[model samples]
Target: MLCVEFFAILFLAYVILSLSFERFLVSRVKELYKSLIPTTSYINSINQAEDIDILTSNLQKLNSEKNLEIELLKKEQDYRREFIGNLAHELKTPLFTVQGYVLTLQDGVKDKKVVKKYLKQTSKGVDRLIYIIKDLDLITKFESGIASLDRKSFDIVEVVRNVFELLEMRASKDKIVLKFDKEYSKQLMVFADKDRIQQVLTNLIINSLKYGTERGVTEVSIEILKENKILIRIADNGEGIDEQHLPRLFERFYRVDKTRSRNQGGSGLGLAIVKHIIEAHDEKIFVESKVRIGSEFSFSLTLNQD
Candidate 1:
């Protein structure tokens, strides 16, 4: 009996020792898991901080770009205002001269021929002043998006013919031959503001006439492409625009020959008006010229398919 009791006691002691060891091992595993959780949380927080920093950097870059754009816009606005002020000042001189001449004549400068000469010059100056003011007004309206187009469908040929007829007197006086090459069909129609389109054509034709060689020919041509657009080209045989000036030809108050242009009564705003008018119709205008050879001003307008 004592031997059996001793064996039972040994078995009980072994079980108790095993249970204590298992409890200690479980406690150690829990402590290890608890410690790892804080490390994982710390790593996640660091990654979040890095991401936030990167986002802040991107935002700052975007802000810098925006600020730069704002500054550019402001500068452009200032330049435009200054340009207009200068143009106004420039225009005022001739206007005041004409006014002074008229006043002098009114104050009894009696030679009829002398008076007539002054009157003619004054009249020319007045006309030039009127032209500049009109062009400036039109540009302002266009830039402000306040210019309304009178959209209509018209035969492109008819418009061309009309413009040709209107400028015939001037062309004849200049001894310049004006011709039209009818490459397109007679019934080609275009969708655009008729008056504005006519204005563009007039400006182009007059520009050609102004710069065309003495007694040289100026040609107007119409070409219809399969791309559903109509091209009108005004070409002149004259001293063509320089490569450097070509890009800025459509800018307001740009002059290739300032003195000659002024003497010829050019306000340097005609081409600019033409450009804006063409663009306002969602069309495009371009120019190509070779020095001493000639220049061709071409513009494309949407065609009426029907």
Candidate 2:
């Protein structure tokens, strides 16, 4: 009987110890599961943060590209507007002139004098059209960067003299005195395209004549600056340009007085061409004007020391 009781007590103690150990293991497993849940949540949050960052960067880049495209589109639109405006103005002049002459001829006034006058007017219109087309072609070539300059070293004074001689007839007809004051030596040479320089000079001189007062003296002076550049000034005592009109002087087809410009036989491209030619030579042009006081147009080009 005693042996039996002792064995039963030992069995009971082993069963209690095993049950307590099982409960402890269950609690430990629950704690480990709770910790794992928080760790998994933290990992998901980190992934979401990375995704947000990536999306933000992409959005910024896309916005930047969109702005750039908008700017390019705006510039293209502006260019188109300017081109169309110039074209219409250019076409309108010759068309109007031709229409006027044709209508006059159709008026049953077939006198020889009337016919001759109409024919001359028609010819002038055609010539103006041709000039406009030529200038437009030149401007297109210049803007497209395909125009080549016939670069050579030549005496600038000689070129100026040639321009004066070439346009002397027109100046004489207009009674505009064309004079050149040599502030530098007669042997001053500049490296540039001879024809282009002559074109620029002629255009400036003609412009001076067109706007100048009757019997007004137009002066062309060349000065050597300390910066090793040469300044060529074309000054005229014309019905001076308005302060507001000065800024747009170099713009294509821009005219201070439209009717007057037309009457004076300007295509409004002369100054623009001058601007481009000077720029091609890596030079700059400037203008100073006072209303009714006269205007001075000047350009500077680097001297060819070599």
Candidate 3:
């Protein structure tokens, strides 16, 4: 009887110990599994990642962004080089002309007529230099956001009429008729910087006159656009630009024909300045042209409600 009791007690003790060990082993296994996997609320630092696919995806994205940044830097460097080169070229022409004329006078030219002629030419060169400098300053101000606009309500129709009158002599010289598409009797008031808007109008109309065919018609038109906007367009029956030229046409000093005449005498920054002015007003400018057909430059403005 004593031997049987002892054997039973030993069996019970063995079973209890086995069950405790199995429960402890299961708890240890659960902790190991948790360490191997990530929880939904887990976050990893930049240098640390638990999942291989997530690491690969993050690396690919970083590489793409780096490549994009490098490409942009390359483009910007090229553009800077081009802009500097163009500026030098534009300034050199007038500078050389003025220097040549001044040297000729310094050589003691005898005839008053010859001296007067050279002086006049020298004066023209100086004027051109001034024009270029002013345009450059204006555009720089615009690009740097240093320019200020005196925004107010003004009659746009009167402004166009005034621009036409101001350029009347130049237009008549080439027999280019500068007129409105239709007569506007009532005032078409707009909210903008009056002087700056005038400058925009003048530049656009001047471009039409300069590039238009002799005796071609240059017309200004204004139409009411939706959302309290007004559209102004300057159209000319001129030698239309090629399709490719229109894209970079507003770029400063960009020319369709590099060999085109400079005798037309412009600062070459007109379109660029016009673009800046319009954009400064939070507006967009557009151009359309067809070879051998014509070109139209247009922009929109906020119509003055009051």
| Number of clashes recorded per candidate | 0, 0, 0
Model 2: what TM-score? 0.76
Weakest lDDT window of 10 consecutive positions for candidate 2? 41-50
Q: Give Cα distance to truth, residue 240, candidate 2, Å.
A: 2.3
Global CA lDDT of candidate 2, please? 0.83
Using TM-score as the measure, name the better of candidate 2 and candidate 3. Answer: 3
Q: Which regions of candidate 1 are displaced past 4 Å?
A: 1-52, 55-59, 182-185
TM-score (C-alpha, index-matched) for candidate 3 = 0.82
Q: Provide the overall lDDT of each model, using Cα atoms, as 2-decimal numbers.
A: 0.83, 0.83, 0.86
**All candidates in order of TM-score, best leading:** 3, 1, 2
lDDT of 2 by residue, 1-306 (tens): 999999999999998887777656545543543454444432233322234454456447857998999999999999899889878978897989998998888886658997998889999888888888999999889989999998888888888888889889989998988888645455777888989988998888888888888888889998889867899999999888888988889988889999888777776899999999999988999999887778899998767787
Per-residue C-alpha lDDT of model 1 across residues 149-173, encoded as one tens digit per residue: 9988898888888998999999999
The order by descending lDDT is: 3, 1, 2
